[model samples]
Target: MIKYALKCEVDHGFEAWFSSSDGFDEQAAKGLVECPMCGSAKVTKAIMAPMVRTSKEEAAPIEMRQAVAEALHKIRKHVEDTHTYVGGAFASEARDMHQGLTPERPIYGEATTEEVKALVEEGVPVAPLPVMADKPAPAVQKKLN
Candidate 1:
């Protein structure tokens, strides 16, 4: 079976499964396929990106992994030391900044999958900061240099 991303003339995008690529072509040609949203038979395959696994997914050497982990830890530590923690309200806070409802500043917090997806879809600039679940962020020095 194969899954295809399809879009209608009205730009309603959807996905459908078929036994083979030829099956989709045949059904579409026969006007058997219709858009689920607008019920439009004038549908075509949408520009879709296929999932691909690369050779780099293989586990690296222990030293390499450790180095990468350390780098991630440093980045998280910098954010913790320099940025504000908004806890679970990250998505709303980010949106506010994007819409100019709130002053923009560096912030770190937890966000739900749906919230993050919505933020990205709406074109709000946000990125995930790596954190070590089993470890703690580095301590900020209190004594001035």
Candidate 2:
């Protein structure tokens, strides 16, 4: 199976799946393919953009690279927009906030295995994110080991 980015003559863009390239050609030749929105048969393949790589190394295909990059970008943006970092004082701060001793806010921080267990046992809502907590501070330059 294959998917093609299709565009109608009216400039509407959409996706279409076919068994093969020949299937797409057959459908187009018979006017079986039409724009879902405008019902126009004047459709053609849309140009796909190549993916951007982070390193000089040759990697997976462009589409897979683009998908992974997009997913990472979305997660990073979500963390930036929705969460606050509490640094190393995560467990105690979380407890304080949960117990009403401190103001509650969306926070991410470092906590030991035992500390996390305690928080869960006490019913203080917490979840781990896919991102690493030891990210370098803005002022510090990171050296890849």
Residue 26, candidate 1: Cα error in Å is 42
Error of 2 at 38 (Å): 50
Which residue pairs clash within candidate 1? none
Report the backbone clash tally of model 1: 0
For model 1, the stretches where C-alpha displacement exceeds 4 angstroms are 1-59, 134-145
Predicted candidate 1 versus true structure: per-residue lDDT over 36-90, tens digit per residue: 5434578899989985659867534555645665776778778899999999999
Candidate 2 TM-score, true structure as reference = 0.42
For candidate 2, the lDDT comes to 0.70
Candidate 2 C-alpha lDDT tens digits along 59-82: 456566445445545565577679
How many backbone clashes does every candidate have?
Answer: 0, 0
TM-scores, each model vs. reference:
0.51, 0.42
Best by TM-score: 1
As for candidate 2, its clashing pairs are: none
- Which segments of candidate 2 are over 4 A away from where they belong? 1-69, 132-145
